[model samples]
Target: MEKEKAHESQNSKLTHENRFGLGSSEHVSIEHDPDDLWGDSRVIVNIGPTHPAMHGALRMVAKLNGETIESSYCQFGYTHRAKEKLGENRTYHQFVVYTDRLNYCSSLLNNVVYAMAVERLMGIEVPPRCTWIRMICCELARVIDHLICIGINAVDLGAFSYFLYGFHQREEAYTLIEKLCGARLTTSYTRIGGLMYDAPDGWEKEVKDWVVRTRKVIDEMDRLLTTNKIWCDRTQGVAIFTKEDCLSYSYSGPNARAAGIDIDLRRDQPCLFYRDVEFDVPIAKEGDVYARYRVRLEEIRQSLNIVAQCADKVKKGPIWSEDKRVKIPDKTLVHNTMEGMIHHFKFFMTGFDVPEGEAYTTFEAANGELGFYIVSKGAPRAHRMRIRGPSVYHYQGLDLMVRGEKIADLVAALGSINIIAGELDR
Candidate 1:
């Protein structure tokens, strides 16, 4: 028909590349065909590998019909350092620093989890004091991670003050970390069979005080956002990823729990001192942006309780295992004695060997299930090392989650998931 031919001709002109070598020029655009609702109306939009709304070096390309996203694809690896490959080449001790870069917001959890995986493979049981301290560190890291997640989620939805409420507490938590390891953001605090050092004198008390302040701040954040009309409008019933969809995409942690998946590795698969601690796993059935926000807020409270319990229970004792092969010589001895200096140099250069074995260790990290799979052929370095970061799986679900939603909702959903580029592209 003549009409069909005319439509085809118009589309061809619209498809032509612009003079500037970008997409089709608007000057050559065509009107929509009567037969097709989306003809010439759908446009492609690139959200970001470098957009402000995007939390990290993540890109989402979407085809849009007006303001609604018709379909989308997420691309990552912009900040990839091939962390797993680095794990293979670097000594187990050296690789601890690399873990810090994974989820830099809560680097301590990554450090603890990586160390735990290597320790399990070596058949080393760290002392009780060490185990308890690791648990406290993990909980503190979880709190900081969740605070940033929800706070930033609010800021994305136009609640800047709400972010500051949690951020102040985040800084307080960092001070405690500094006291423990002399570093704040990327504190490489956990060592193979021990920590960098035991908590400095009165560090536990400071942690407890931080917890008390954080709880009040959390309550304030809940009051500020949970019932506010605009916040509810932006988040409630938006980007609803069902429980079935979550399972299909391998969702874990708060994101999965928000969809009514009653899984918390810390509870279901108890590791370290998880079995000894008393805490609750928060769950929500709605699975909307609001539900995800609520889940994280509640998680922060639970982590606070865990930190308090740890502070009360942790007592003075050896923080490292007696295993000479894994333990680092004391700093004072290493500096003062010639034999100690030589031992230290050899340890750093050659590294200790692990037994010929393989082990996969999973922990309930801040974002979700963080796992380290190690295959060792009795070498100082891993034969093969793989990290299973939750962001990879969570990011995969983004396309499905954003389909049919407005472009603004994409920002909300992405922030709620807390996609870390290091872990995602690893």
Candidate 2:
């Protein structure tokens, strides 16, 4: 009882002196108590709408008690491109370019998912070769995205050399993408009913060779970064989110898998050549920054396996559906005949019509279960289009994840989740 009274007295003595309006200065002066560890240490810190550690245009408003975040909330939409709104205004084929901007780190994944959604609406199934080629592209994109995520995560944590190892592989992957489509960062390779172009003659062999080289680099990175004392100390047990927290926030993909959720859309809800291929989904129960990194690292290896399998399965065949309604006219036919030229002009000008029905297609994209919800009214464009980017849901949990963690851990948590601003703010 005496100790309780003494503690109350100490708290009473530590009240802010400026609460009674006794000062002209804006600063609040608190009476220091020797027993109080947080005396005058609580303050609000804004971590970015423009900061390097943020990875993108993410703003974290945190209330800090010394070095630890007492409470926090995140803010986004600094780069609102209104991608969904643009979908309604443009034809389905034209919107493929917009999807690329969502998760630019793996634009091919976005391209594939959007095309799948449109194809489902039209009841079109692309050829076997196209399906196998898409699987390879999706897996390659997955590796590229994971590499960027893990590499950037390391960069934020002061592992500069670690990023370089994955970065070289990413550049090689981008070169392959460039060969498939003329563009690198914003690749609109998938048309509504098929691919913009078929893989080059030696593309499969090149992809297999790249995968082999990537495997070696990944192993080297694992040896260098996994057991490093500084990395473990900084990441291991920091920013933990329980499985319940992840489910509550609608988390999917590696971020959810790291939190002990074993759901992968490719395994549970198979699409395209996913049912035919074999790849393991990596899971971790710790749900910390380190666990997320490890999951992505393992996923990269699995992606390599998928790419190799797909390279073997892919054969020379038609890469487009037989649906004349959605198919683009051949270049030779367009140049030789007036009928083909008119058809080609019409295809580009009016676009292809989808049936009067709604379809939502979700794919196991690099980050998570990326879904596209399209409502069609049998027109050239969708009546309404909604994109379910994983970054938005993952970003929502940042406040809960960062509370009681050090400010530096916030950087680790944000990078670990790999929130691309284009996806988050779209």
Q: Residue 399 of candidate 2: its Cα lDDT?
A: 88
Pairs that collide, model 2:
none
What TM-score would each prediction reach against the true structure?
Answer: 0.91, 0.92
TM-score of 2: 0.92
Clashing pairs in model 1, backbone N/Cα/C closer than 3 A: none
Please estimate how well model 1 matches the true structure, expressed as its whole-model Cα lDDT. 0.90
List candidate 2 segments past 4 Å from native: 1-41
In model 1, how many backbone clashes occur? Answer: 0
Q: Please, what is the whole-model Cα lDDT of each candidate in the order they appear?
A: 0.90, 0.91
How well does model 2 score by local distance difference test?
0.91
Alpha-carbon shift of residue 273 in model 2 (angstroms): 1.1
Best by TM-score: 2
Locate the minimum summed-lDDT window of 10 residues in model 2: 22-31
